[model samples]
Target: MVSRELIARHCICCGGGNLEKSPAVLMPFVALRVFGHEPVEITEDWGLRDLRQGMAYTLCNSLQCQNCGALFLDYRFTDEQMEALYRNYRDELYNEQRIRFEPGYANVPPHYHQRANYLCEVEAWLAPYLPEAPAVLDFGGDSGINSLFREHNQLLHIHDISGVELVPGAERADLERIRQCHYDLVTCSQVLEHVPYPLDFVKQMLPALGTGSLIYVEVPHEALLRAHPGSLQLATCKRHWHEHVNFFTESSMRVLLESLGLVVVDVLHLPVDIGWTQGEVMGLLARQA
Candidate 1:
């Protein structure tokens, strides 16, 4: 019998029940790389017992939506599981545990503290669509370190679950405050890939937008997906599931935004050089219709 949590009942992007399945593994360590890890005996110490099968690493399927071409892990993680996986969130403690599991894992924290180089280009691309001094809200933007238009924005708000300290000039906000206040632009960057339900996640931010307010969503155009463009056979290529579970295609992204009653103003594939790696980002700029 398969664990109910390991079954994807419907397409997360298009709500389609028809999906194709392929073999994939849920890495116990939750590190980025799927291969070249030091073989360590699986144990409950990693805190993924519920997801494991009698001390064996969890073997699961990758489901691809036939309707929209979105590839994602078949497993639907619970809120508690998500919290446990991201408790320290790349801090020293988190890195120590991860390094213990995969010695090849680079223990150095990826530049979460530094502002991303791509945001400058992102801000420029969005300049024409936004007000001169937009009230910006960065949902899931940790520390507001890379919030776009920071200097020019009338107000910069950071709404994140990580509980990381905000940089100077960035105000912290809760969901209720987000509902009460309207923002000219809400940026959900580099976050959709990790979420189980992208549609529901974006829907939560809808109330913050008044008419014509724009939401900028960015996700990595994962190497596998880009290499096999328009091919639904990505499940075969993506044999391991890490923090980034959902692999979005341009068609799938458009479907997600349109289903939410948002107008897709533009979809761009932007090049990025983030010190550690050079890759592409799929940026979707949408507005309340």
Candidate 2:
């Protein structure tokens, strides 16, 4: 396999050069299970030729920004690698490979097909802020199956890199089309954690925001980071990097949006029980400043 370079230099949230780095290990199974690359291939490609005895994973680093307290994996996957990682995303074949490495993964895919219970709470919370029958776009939202207001929206559009078939009433749109169209609400749910450059990813969506447009960004309120709020020592504890690379603090989320000239409407911590797992989500609501 070709070499995959680590591209993260500065903090993705605040763009800070001053970062704290700590040794971390990325399990070899992630290569085969998630990206379809073999363990030995990526280990060699990543230049960890000297795999110590009993070590079957790639040695990497976890970085935390001193400026904004954002924690993420040091590796920033390239576009090609990102494509490979999420190509089949949560589909049957993807689940099979993952289940080969982690048996527990088998229980997760069925939940993906169901309409997320969190969307009900999210829609209700957003109701007072949104207009009646708003035109909505779900960025990186696969199939628009769990998109808020899917049933009530005047127009519902889904922009996803994954080529999954959309559910009824949802139209597939390209990024350029999304930029040209004026959407009242743009929802990017459970996407930031997987992205290598969260800041740049959100910046790309700026053109889609009209004056009254509201952008909703949601990420897992990672337990480890939440347990030790504002602590730089998080890097030492985060030994393994998986699909969810960036773990955002509430302050870091604010900095990310505010830096983009967005007026922060509200930041919420919602408890979610998605059948498979119960966790908290850090949901941020923002509009054009």
Candidate 3:
């Protein structure tokens, strides 16, 4: 017997309307054959892989949330399914496998030594809002590569699905522990898109902070994607399209933030000069109101 799962009633962001499902555009994998040379790559088999086999691709349909402009799959996978996906979510698999990176990522400038430079950029951006040795909560900060406070004596905590947590001077950011006190800043980069409900993700994280606390969010500049739909599909495909269900534009992001009682301080359109992926990423700085 098939089990019945609860459906998300309205737009996860705006709570305004039903999410509309759209058709699939791109495929992440290529053909493998004995005679033809196969290119080595590391790609998570996002439910969309098998048709010949009995495995199913439940969310091949795109669920676009018109109210807040978040386009994602409408289906809410069960905890069991989610566990299966993230239980073995390895951050280093891509590196350990030495999977050939997309030409765009390897040819990108920010790819090499990006961790250090990224920290510098983040430091500069948060300088105004951050106090010396400020407490930082790195939500979904994989292996803490995006943290800038480790060098300083600042308190930095990382919470991620990846089982491994290894960042110097950084402790595990437990959700319950985070709620104990307000933090100086919160950073979530390249994470919102992965979540099924962007609003719930923010809400869960928001309680850990309070008014005057700052939140820094970075996502693919999907607004820029309007100009290149094909590239958008390919980008999502290369980035593991199944995992990234929500697509947000700048205006949509602002709407979502403002609805949550946050003030948008800044928005940035970050175009890649170097990296395994080539595209525009939007950065937003907001303060809890």
Q: Candidate 1: which pairs clash?
A: none
Summarize candidate 2's per-residue lDDT along 156-273 as a digit string, tens digits. Answer: 9998877888999999989778878989999999999998878778887888899799999999999897789779878888888888888999888899888889989988899889
The TM-score measured for candidate 2 stands at: 0.90
Candidate 3 RMSD to the real structure: 8.1
Each model's C-alpha lDDT?
0.83, 0.83, 0.61
- What are the root-mean-square deviations of the candidates from the true structure over C-alphas? 5.8, 4.6, 8.1
**True lDDT of residue 222, candidate 1:** 89
Q: Which whole-number lDDT from 0 to 100 does residue 263 have in model 1?
A: 90
lDDT assessment of candidate 1: 0.83
Model 1: per-residue Cα lDDT over 1-289, one tens digit each: 1123435778888888888888877786862233224335656677874666344456778889888899999877667667877787877877887877667667346665678888889899999998899999999988888888888899999999988888889999999898888899999999999877788899889988897789999999988888888998677777888888899999989998989889999988998998777999999999988
Off by over 4 Å in 1: 1-6, 31-56, 107-110
- Residue pairs with backbone overlap in model 2: none
- In terms of TM-score, the best-performing candidate is 2
Q: After superposition, how far is residue 100 of candidate 3 from its true place, in Å?
A: 13
Per-candidate total of colliding backbone pairs: 0, 0, 6
Where in model 2 is the C-alpha error above 4 Å?
A: 1-5, 33-52
Instruction: Using TM-score as the measure, name the better of candidate 1 and candidate 2.
Output: 2
